[model samples]
Target chain A: MRNSIDTGAVICSVFAAVALFGAGSLLALMGYLVLKGLWPPMRALAALIFAHSGDSLLSIWIRSLFLLLAATLLALPLAIGTGIYLSEYTRQNRARELILSNIAGLGEMPPVVYGLVGWGALAPYFGEDRQTLVIVLTASVWLLPQLIVAAYWALQEIPVSFRRDSLALGATRWQTIRWTLMPYSGRLLAAKTLEGMARVGGEAAPVIMVAAAWPDSSKQPLHILPYYLYRSLIEAVDPATTRHFGAALLLVLTSVCFQWAALRLRRTGVVAGDTLPGLRKR
Target chain B: MRDSKLVVRNLSVYYGDFQALRSINLSIPLGAATAVIGSSGAGKSSLLRALCRMNELWDNVRTEGQVLLDGQEIYGPDVDVTEVRRRVSLIARHPYPFPKSIFDNVAYGPRLHGIKDKRKLDEIVKRSLKQAGLWNEVKDRLQESALNLSPGEKARLCIARSIAVEPEVLLIDDPTYHLDPVSAAKVEDVILELKQKYTLVFATNSMQQAGRVSDYVAFLSEGALVEFGPTSEVFARPKDRRTEDYITGRFS
Candidate 1:
C-alpha cells in the first residue's frame, strides 16, 4: 500500500506538471503574438475607418468576413437536414453505413482539393469573372461534411431516454424530434456551428487556388484575409514580416473568439441544468 | 385474472438475431400493482416495453405477441399507435422531465392530445401533480424548470406527467432504480396510492420492494417466468427452485 500510494502521488505530480507546462506554452504564444503583431494593424484599421479611406486591407478583411458568412449560410441548412436524415430517419443498414463512411472520407480530404475542383471544372462553366461566387461555392462544399458530422454527433449525444420518454407520452416520431430531441440538442448544435464557422473561415488554400486562377481577369480580385496573409508570408521582406504577423494574429483571434463562444454556450447549458448529463448530477 | 386489464399471449421479443424474451403469457389484474421481479437482462424491461409497443421504437427490435388492452388487440394493423401509447403510458427507469417548467412538463401530454384551454390545462396539471403526491412540493414553483427538482421530486414529476394523460394502465419500469432509499420509499408510497385508480405494472430488481409495493409478483429468470402469484403467497411458498433460490439470495 505504501509503494502504491507513492507511485500514485508521483503520477499525479507528473500529470500536474504536464498540464501546467501545456497551459504556460499556450499563454506565452498568445502573449507573444498580441505584443508583436496586434497593435500596428489595429491602429491602421482604426485610422482608415476614421478617415473614411477604402484601404485595401480593410476591404480584404470585410470580403473575408462576407465569404465566411456566405459559406455558413449556404451550408447550414443542408448540413442540418442531412444530419437529421442520417441520425433520425435512417435505419442501421448497409446504405446508412455506406453514406456515413463516405462522409467520413470526405471530411478527411484536404480543402485544397475542393479548390482545385472549383478552378478546373467549375471555372470554365461560370467563367473567371465570378470569383466570389465560385469561391463561396467551393468553400461551402468543403464546409458541408464537417458541419454535418458535427450536427450528427451533437444530435447523437442526447440520451436515448429522452426519446423514449417523449414517445411514451404519446408523442409521434416527428413530434418527439421537434419537441424533445431538437430542443435538447440546440446548444450543442449551435456550438458545433460556431466551431465549423471558425474552421471554414481560417481555411486559406481553397480561396487561394480559386482566386489565383483568375489573376489576369478584368474584375477586381476578391480580397480575403487568409489569402492576403499567405501572400505576405510568401513574399516576406523586412517590411512584410509585421504585416504577416498581424494577419496571423487577426485570424487566430477570430478562431479563438469562436471557440470561446462555443465553450461558453456549452458550459452555460450544463450549468443551467438543461441537459441530461446535468440532470444526472442529483 | 377474471377482470384483467391487459392480457399477454405468446409474447416474444428479439433484438436482431438475439432473443431477449421467449414466448410468455400473463394476465395483468385490473386496479392492482403487478411487479415483474428479475435480475438484469432477464427480459423484465422488454416485457414492459412490449406491453405498450415501445420496443418498436428501437432499431432491429421485433416483437411477436398479442397485447390485449381491455380485450382489444393493441398490435392490430388498424390500431393507431399513438392512441395505444396514450392509453397505456410508461414511466422509464430514469426520470426524464422535459427541459421545461414544472407545469409544462405535466401539461405536455394534455397539450399533445389537443387540450387548449388554459384553465382546463391548469386544473389537469394541478390534479395530476396532486395525484402523484408532488403538488405541495412544487405548487409554488410551477414555472421553474423541472430539471431543477430533486431526484425524488423528478421521479414524482415523471409520474405526474404520465397520469396527466389519464392513461388506463401505468407501466413503470424500476422507478426507484436511481433513487436513494428514502426517495424510493416516497415513490413506493405514490405507487401504492396510484394503484387504486390505474392498473399498475412495474418491473423491479428487489424482492423486498416487490413484496412491499405489489399485490401480485411475477418472478422471471433467463427470459422465462419462474413463478407468479400473490405477493404473500410467492414469498411464503415459492413453487420453483429458481424462484426459491432467487428470493433466498442464492444468486442475483
Candidate 2:
C-alpha cells in the first residue's frame, strides 16, 4: 500500500500498449490500401477468380493447385518413408545422425538449384518441352526435406507403447507402421503437407524458368497466381497493379489459412513432448 | 512342470552392462494363470517381454536364456519375432488404443493376420470384446474413436484387441495397476474367465493381485526368481526368506 503504483502492472501495460501500437499501424496501412481503389481490387479479384484475358482464372488456379498436389503426392511417399525409418527404425547409429544433421540444410537449399537439377537430369528422362513436368519435379524435390523433417518429428512424438502394442498383437514392423503409426499422425501429416503446398504456391524463381518458355503457347500446362502477380507488379505497372493486389490478397489468405490449420491441428492432435491437450484438464 | 505351456530356463536379461533379470527358471502351466510378483524393479515386465521377445526392441539389450512356447524356442536364431509375438501376446500397464473406432482397434490384429472378411472381423471383434468383458459398454459407439473411452474402458479395449488375434498365451503387465477399485475388480474377473481357455502370465507388483487371479505365483526379488510354486502353497508357506520377507511386508 506504501507505493500504490505496481511496477509489474505498469510494465505489463507498457508492453501491451506497444503491441497495440504496432497492430494499429498495421491496421492503418491495410485500411488505407483497402479504402484506396477498393473497387479495382475487388474487380481484379473477380476477374482472377472468374475470367481473365490471358488464361481462365479458374483453370490456372486449378492447374496450380493440382501441380502442388501432384508434386506432393509423388514425393511424399519417399519423404514419409525416410521420416519413419529415421524415427521408428534407426537407433544411435551413424546413419541417423548424418541424415538428421544434413536434412534441414538440404531442405533449405535454393529453389533455383533444384530447378537446374530437374532441368539437366530429369528433363532428359521426360523428353523436350515438358517444362511443367520439370517444374513439378523441382517443387517436389524442394519440398522433400521439409516433409521428412515434419513427418519424422510427428512420428517421433507418437508413444512407443503404440508400436509395442501393435507388435505384441503379432503385427510385423511394416503393418504396425501402416496401421498404428500412420493413423496417430494423420492430422500432423495433413497439416505439414498443406503448409508445404502453401509454401510452394508462393515460390516463383524455379517455376518461372520452366513455365515462361510457353507463356503464349496453346498448351499452357501451368500458370500460378504468384508468378503472374510478380510479372504484373514489376512489368505492367499501370494496368496490372489492381489485379496484383487481388492476387496478393489471395496469396496471403492461402498462406494464413494453412498456418491457422496447422496450428489448430497441432493443438488437437496428440503431439510428442507435450501433455495431450484433451487430458490436460484431468 | 512337464505339462507347462511355456518354459524358461536360466533366463537372464541385461541392458548394456546393467542386468535387469538374473538366471530364472519359470514354468507357466497350460490353461492356468501364473503371476510374477515383485517390487518396482523386480524385472516382472522384462520377464513378460522376454517371453514374447519384445526386449529385442531395445538397443544394447542382452538376453541369455531359453524361452520355449509349445516346445518351440521363442528366442531361437531362426524364430521370427512377429510369429513369436503372435503366439504370445502382451498387454501393457497403460492402455494404447489407436485413434480409431473401438471396432477398428479390436479388428487391427485379426486384419494384420490376414483376416480380411468384414463379417469375420466383426465377429472376432465382438467376441474378443465380450471375452474382455467390454462388449456391453462399447456396443453402441463402435464407430467412435477409441480415444474418447474412459481409462478403464481403454484398458479393456486393449485386452479385447490382444485376444482378438487368438494368441495361445497372454503376457499381461499389471492390468489393474492404474485402474479404480471397480475397474480393477472387473479386470480381475476377466482374468479369471480367461484362464479357463488360455494361459495367462501376469507381471504385477501387487501381491494381493497375484493371490486373487493367479493359480501359481512366482516371487521375484531384485531380478531373481526367489520362489515359484502353487499360489496357495507359496502364500501359505514361502520357502525362501526373501520371498517370505516380501509377502510379510518385512522389506520389499
Candidate 3:
C-alpha cells in the first residue's frame, strides 16, 4: 500500500529532469571558467590566484575578504538578535507577521537597486574613504535580511522544547539563547555566514557604484571581483581577458572551499546536537 | 495554606478568545508528588505550565486570579518570571538535550546561576547526574555528545539538568508519555526519588501512571477541577462521580 509508483512519479520526474538540465548549464559554466583560468595565455595559472597586472593577486583577494568579513561581522549580531527576538520574545500578531514578510521580500530585491541607493545616500558621507565604507554598508544591508531569515528559519527548526527545557532549568531568556539555542544552531549559523560571503563575492553591481571612480590597476585595495571581470571585458585598457578569467577562477575556488568547509562543519557538528544519519560515522 | 507549596485560587487561563482553564482552585502540598490527571485537552498541562509560568513562552495566553508559590503571587505584574522559574522547574513531556556534551548540558544550569568555579560545577554535575541515576552509565563519556545517548538516557539527563539548578518545585509534565515502557519505568522511578528532595507536580492522562508516581492526585476535566485529595484517599474513595467513573474505567 505504501510504495506504489504512479502517474505522480512520472510527472515529478519530468520536472526533475528540467531542474537537472538547469544545473547542468551551471556546471558547464564553471568548467568553462576553470578552463579559461588554467589554459596557456594565462600560463602561470599560479599568476591568476597569486598575482595580476600591477597588483598582487593576494592583496586584491585579502581586500575583498576584509570587506566581506567585516560586513558579515557587522550584520551578524543585528541579524541574530532579530532572529532571537522574533523567535522567543515577540508574540505572534500583525506586527510580527509584517516584519517577517518584509524580511522575506527584502531578499528578493535587486542588488543593483541597493547599489544605486548606496551611491546616492552614502557617497557624500564618506569622501576619500567612500569606497570601503560604501562597500561595507551596502554589503551589510544586502546580507542582513539573508542572515536574519536564515537565523529565523534555523531557530524555528530547533525544537521549541529546547527553549522550554532551558527555561524550566531556571535559565532566563538570554541564558536560554546563549546556552541552548545558540549552540544547537552553530552549524546553521556557520553555513549562512559562508553563503553571505559567497553572495558578496558574486555580486558586482553594488561594488561598481562604490569603486568605479578608482581604477582597477590603482590597487586601492578594494574589490567585488565580478565587477572587475566586467571592467576587464569592456575596457580597452586591459586587452588581456586572461586576468579577468584568472580572478573569476580564484573567486570560484574560494567559494568552493568555503562551501566545502561548511559541509564538513555540518557533517561534524561544532557542538553536540544530534546529526544526520549520514554524518554519524564521521 | 502555609503547608501547601503552591496554591491556585480562582485561577483561569485563556488563549485569546477561548478559555483553556475555567476558574479552578487547588493546593499542592510541599515536598510531595501531586499528579494532575485528565484526558487530552483537559487543562492538565495548562495547570502544570501555569505553576512555573512556562505558559508565558507562548502568545496571547492570559491568566486571571492568583497562583501563589510559597507566598508570592506568580502572575502579578512586576514579578520577575525568571526568579519564579528558578524556584519552579518543568520537565516537559519529551526528552530535550542541549547541543553539548553530557557534562555541559548538566552544567548549564549551575553556570547560569553564576557557579563559575570549575570544581563547584563538577561537584554539582556529578551529584545531579548521580541522583538522576545516570552518572555511572555516562561517567566514562561525560564529554561525549548528549545526542548520542539512548532516548531513555536523554530523558534522565534532562532530569539531571533540571535538578542541577536546585529548584524548589519540580513540574513534570507527562513524564513518560512518549517513552518506551522501560524508559517510562525508569523516569517514573526518578520522579519517585525526586519527590524526596523537591516538591513535584506531575501532569499525566493515564490513571495508572498517576497511581504509580503521585502522592496526591488532582483530577481535572473540561478545564475544571473535578476532585483533589491524597492519592490513597482519592483513588480509594472519590467524592465526585466523574472522578470515580474515571478511576474505575467507566469513563475517561
Tens digit of lDDT per residue, candidate 1, span A1-282?
Answer: 899999999999999999999978867777777677665566754454344445355566677888888988899889988988898888868898898888978876888888787788777668876777887888788888888887787678777777788889898988888877788677888898888778878888887778767766645444578877887777666663456666676787778889999988787662244445643210
Distance from true position, residue A184, model 2, in Å? 2.8
| B93 Cα displacement, candidate 3 (Å) | 1.1
The positional error of residue B112 in candidate 2, measured at the CA in angstroms, is 2.3
Off by over 4 Å in 2: A1-37, A40-52, A55-63, A92-94, A110-128, A205-223, A236-240, A267-282
In what order do the candidates fall by lDDT, top score first?
1, 2, 3
- Candidates 1 and 2 compared by lDDT, better number: 1
lDDT of 3 by residue, B1-252 (tens): 228999999989998888889999998999888999888888988888888898877677898879998888998888888889888988877757877799999998889888999999999999999999898999999999898898889989999998999999988888887789998898888888898999999898788889988889999999999999999999999999999988888972
Interface RMSD of each: 1.4, 1.2, 1.7
lDDT of 1 by residue, B9-90 (tens): 9888999898888888899999999999988999999999999999887789988879899999999999999999999999
**Residue range A1-282, candidate 3, lDDT tens digits:** 334566678879999999998978767767887777666665565755566554555667777788788999999999999988887777778998899999978966888877876776776566555577777888888889888887886676666667778788778888888877787677777887787678766788887776644444353645456766666677757564567777777677778778878677666654334432322100
Q: B208, model 2: CA deviation in Å?
A: 1.7
Query: How many backbone collisions does model 2 have?
Result: 0
**What lDDT score goes with residue A100 in model 2?**
83
DockQ (Cα-based) per candidate?
0.65, 0.67, 0.68
lDDT of predicted model 1: 0.84
Model 3 earns a TM-score of 0.88
